[model samples]
Target: MNFSSKLLQNAVEEFGRLPGVGKKTALRLVLHLLKQQDAEVARFTSSLNLLKEKIQYCKECYNISDEEVCEICLSVKRDKSTICVVEDTRDVMAIENTNQYQGVYHVLGGLISPMDGIGPSDLKIEGLIQRLRQGAVKEVILALSATMEGDTTIFYLYRKLKEFDVQVSTIARGIAFGGELEYVDEITLGRSILTRVPYERNVG
Candidate 1:
């Protein structure tokens, strides 16, 4: 193949590697980029590069940040006594879009999945425990998914945090089983936050 053809194929392969993009969609994206002006493609590539180069995890909450701390963590207007724990950055974005939560967040990076070899140690649980030990937070809200892994992670965190004096809670059942927070509507997420339940141990 010629240089231009090879470039197109490379772009398609890169796009294909994305989570849900197939060969056809990858090809479409490559063709779309090809039609754009050189400067436009440059701008797109630069933005993509900056996503990795500029963004960093907030030291306080583990959320994505352009600086040392995320905006939510830095905001004095937010309720510092509450911390919402989520499985990923997308979950953080989902809850933020709801505009209902006034507290800060702690992104666990992932859920506990034994089949996938992801355990509590692999998440940010240690950070959360340390944060609780600081005694500033009065509540830790588990905003994890309603799936099996989500439940497992929640239980694990609950067991560990039970020793702490802080109150522990989980989002309500407004979200359906097997549903992901990223796909849930903002209104549903807001309602779930409004109707959160305390994390009960040994419920029959």
Candidate 2:
């Protein structure tokens, strides 16, 4: 087979580096991009660059933001007395899409997975503790996934925050086992939030 054009191969390799994108799909995307006009390709490339250049993690919650603090953390309408704990910014977006939560959030970056070598200290847990110590937060909702790693992360947080005196709860298991928040419907997410149960450190 005559592999023509190093530029096309380079584009395919770059796209393939993205999560879940296979070599075939990457090649397809590269071919599609090649068919686009130079101006359109420029626009697409610029937008991708802008995403990295414009967004930075909010210092308080670790959520992606274009400024020092995310819009959610700065909004006066949001309840500062409640914080939803999530594994990543995608989960924050998922919950926000429901438009049912009024509180701010704390992104843990990732969950606890001993097999994956991710520990409690590897997450943004210290920031959560700092926020709690600052007071005024009445509740902390654990909105992690229903996986074993998610369960482990929640348990670790439950123990860590037990001394804070603020109510700590977990979003209900209304979401199917092993379901990721990003894949759940808005109504189901809202219901799970509404039916969240208090965290009893003693129970499983």
Candidate 3:
């Protein structure tokens, strides 16, 4: 696309770099921003700048947070004995929307995708193990997506967590194969969580 202004072209290019944003969509976004008042544009950019500068990862669960620890991890009302393991903050948000789980969460940065070079070391597995070692947790639910990588991560985690006394379980297959938690509806996701099965049963 040709642009009369380099500033507009640059803005479009930058916006296009975002996932799922094509050049056309990026152009639309840039044009919309350009139409906004200067103060409104400043506020929008300021919020993004502040997010990049001040966002913190929770020390305990590695979820995105404004503080050193996420509110869920610090909540007294949460079930400290049950930890729901998810792929990222988005998955955490998806699960939270269900309002069916009182347990806290552990966010693995990503799943174990060998093709993408993501492995256990690339995730927050050790921190999760450490939490389990502290002995407060009684159950660890593997709430990863129903993809091959998700299954791989769950199997690896099950092996590692089996050494611990905690019960290792996985969300029910109410989710079809290859489904990501973020895209699943709240009711199905909530029911899957409610009817999780022991990880050992799926192994053989």
Candidate 4:
């Protein structure tokens, strides 16, 4: 796309770097921002800068937060004994929208995708194992997506946690194969969480 100004072209290029954003969409966004008041644009840029500088991953669960520990981990109302394991912060938000789980979470950061060069050692699996060893957790819910990578991660986690006294379970197959938690409807996701089965039964 041709631009009258280098500054506008630079902004569009930067916006295009975002996932799912094309050059046309990025140009549109840049134009929209150009129409906004100077103060409004400043606020928008300032918020993004602050987010980059201030965002912190929760030391306990690896979830994104503003402090050392996430608000969910610190909540007294959450079930400390049940840890719902998910892929990332987006999945955490998806499950929270269902209002079906009271348990705390353990964000795996990402799945074990060999094709993508991600492995158990690259994830936060060791932290999860350490939490299990602490003995406060009684159940570990594999709330990962129904993708192959998700299954691989769950299986790896099961093998690691088998010696721990904690019960390992997986969300019901209400979600179709290859389905991502973030894209599923709230009711179906909530039911899946409610109808989770033992890891042994799920695999058997």
lDDT of 3 by residue, 34-99 (tens): 999999999999999999999999999999999999999899999999999999999998999989
In order, candidate lDDTs are 0.90, 0.91, 0.93, 0.94
What C-alpha lDDT, on a 0 to 100 scale, does residue 69 get in candidate 4?
A: 99
Ranking by TM-score: 3, 4, 2, 1
RMSD of 3: 6.8
Colliding residue pairs in candidate 1: none
Residue 184, candidate 3: Cα error in Å is: 14
lDDT of 2 by residue, 1-204 (tens): 134988778878889999999999998898898899999999999998999788799999999888999999999999999999999999998999999999999999999999999999999999999999998899999999878999899999999999998999997556776899999999778978897767683245
Residue-level lDDT of model 1, residues 1-204, one tens digit each, is 243578788878889999999988989898998899999999999998999788899999998888898899999899999999998899998998989999999999999999999988999989998999899989999999888999999999999999988899998667776889999999888877887666583131
What's the lDDT of the predicted structure labeled candidate 4? 0.94
- lDDT-based ranking, best first? 4, 3, 2, 1
Model 3: clashing residue pairs? none
Cα-based lDDT at residue 110, candidate 4: 96
* Number of clashing residue pairs, candidate 1: 0
Backbone N/Cα/C clashes per model: 0, 0, 0, 0
Give TM-scores for every candidate, taking all chains together and pairing residue i with residue i: 0.81, 0.82, 0.84, 0.84
> Tens digits of per-residue lDDT for model 4 on 72-146?
999999999999999999999999999999999999899999999999999999999999989999999999988
On TM-score, the stronger of 1 and 4 is: 4
What lDDT is obtained when candidate 1 is compared to the true structure? Answer: 0.90
